[model samples]
Target: MNNLPEDCIAKILSLTTPRDVCRLSAVSRIFSSAADSDDVWNHFLPSEFPAGFAAPEGLPTRKRLFFSLVDNPLLLLHDPPHLVSF
Candidate 1:
């Protein structure tokens, strides 16, 4: 548990959902760090998620960008016939 490297823990956490990762963060210091790692969040983000598009001017982390998108999704109206939220 605590002995596991942060990268290893992040790899394992990547297989789980965002909600699950957040819950596991409190289990240990390593878990908390792993949960906040970009590797874990990358798995949670969509495969087609645009690069650098979601990030704000301040250059937020992948996790913050993920939650930001989740809480306030971007509306894509480029195609009038098919409006979508990214």
Candidate 2:
């Protein structure tokens, strides 16, 4: 797997679950870098995210953004009569 190109490795990792990716990172430095690649992590983010909406301030990379969303989901908006969820 280390012999493969980084893009190829990222593509393969992108198909895997987040838990699988974390385990794969333990295999080797190459896999660790591949697992942390934005190309791979971007697959875990919601498609609607950062599109019609903006991620809250301070979340840096795609990985951070993914975990942040999982840890604390965003509330789109709230009004007296209605509530919006994201």
The candidate that achieves the highest lDDT relative to the unseen native structure: 1
lDDT of 2 by residue, 1-68 (tens): 67898888889999999999999989989888988897788899865444323445786567777787
Tell me model 2's lDDT, rounded to 2 decimals.
Answer: 0.75
At residue 26, give the lDDT of candidate 2. 91
| Clash count for each candidate, listed in order shown | 0, 0
Per-residue CA lDDT of candidate 1, range 1-86, in tens? 78878899999999999999999999988899999998899887776665445466564789987887788776644333322565
C-alpha RMSD values across all candidates: 4.0, 4.6
Candidate 2: TM-score? 0.76
Q: Which stretches of candidate 1 lie above 4 Å from their native place?
A: 51-54, 75-86
Residue 7, candidate 1: how far off, in angstroms? Answer: 0.4
Query: Each model's TM-score?
Result: 0.78, 0.76
Residue pair clashes in candidate 1? none
